[model samples]
Target: MFRFLPLPEGALCLIAATAFCAEYLLFYFHSTSHKGLEGYYHLILVLLIGLCVVSSVAGALLPTSFPVDLTNGIAITLQGLWFYQTAFSLYGPMMPDGCQLTGDQIACGSAASRVRGELLANFQLFSLVLGVLVAVVVSYGYAASRHGRS
Candidate 1:
């Protein structure tokens, strides 16, 4: 109902990117200590978000005749990435062949397990944020397109 924004695409992308930034800043940072690595990660993430916002705005500004197939493709790609990430986290350090803790290495292994758990939890949290952002963006885009028509 509030589809007055000129660049709904940019708005949606901004929302999603903001969620991603929050997740990476809050949860993922706890899993590592390498300042250099963190810097690199943040750099990559910022660039990615920047790209998304730019593309979204460009898409919105272009002629409506522009094909939406690319948007659909991106949505599909993100779904696949999210699924892959979720599957990877499901196999956290467990047993059989996971993070097998030997006798003397129990302490160190336990520590590793704790770290792994934190990582997985962060992953899940980020995944949730991403999912919500996607939903909001898609919904906003749909509403904006419909409103644009009338």
Candidate 2:
């Protein structure tokens, strides 16, 4: 199935898989720690997983006419991936600021939040790498597809 798909499509699939693994591992470790406000972190992780799924599907369906207009399916999918990465990971640290939890709960919450931040940073890194790979693949695919035909 992937044989005919553009390189960007395959790369996005790999990126999505990588993101899911990171999310799952991060949550698994946090959950086992009996941390506070773990529910919120888990919720965010679930959202990331959803984003990954969307990216993979959209990339697969991206038209040959994409990388032309600004509203292409592939562009939308890439934007979604960027938004998810930036909003969730880089912004995760501030999401739990000034919590109402007290004592041990507060400590646990802060620690849990830090774990989330670390995970977010890692996710963003992977996203950035994936974005670059997608660009490269798309550029090459576009040029290759157009060569000798135009």
Please report the candidate that would top TM-score against the real structure.
2
How close to the true structure is residue 136 of candidate 1, measured as C-alpha lDDT?
62
Per-candidate TM-scores read: 0.32, 0.32
Model 1 ranges with Cα > 4 A deviation: 3-9, 33-98, 101-150
- Backbone collisions counted per model: 0, 0
> Which pairs clash inside model 2?
none
lDDT of each: 0.46, 0.52
What is the overall TM-score of model 1 with all chains considered together? 0.32
User: lDDT of candidate 1 vs native?
Assistant: 0.46
How well does candidate 2 score on lDDT at residue 62?
Answer: 57
> Candidate 2: minimum summed lDDT over ten consecutive residues — where?
63-72
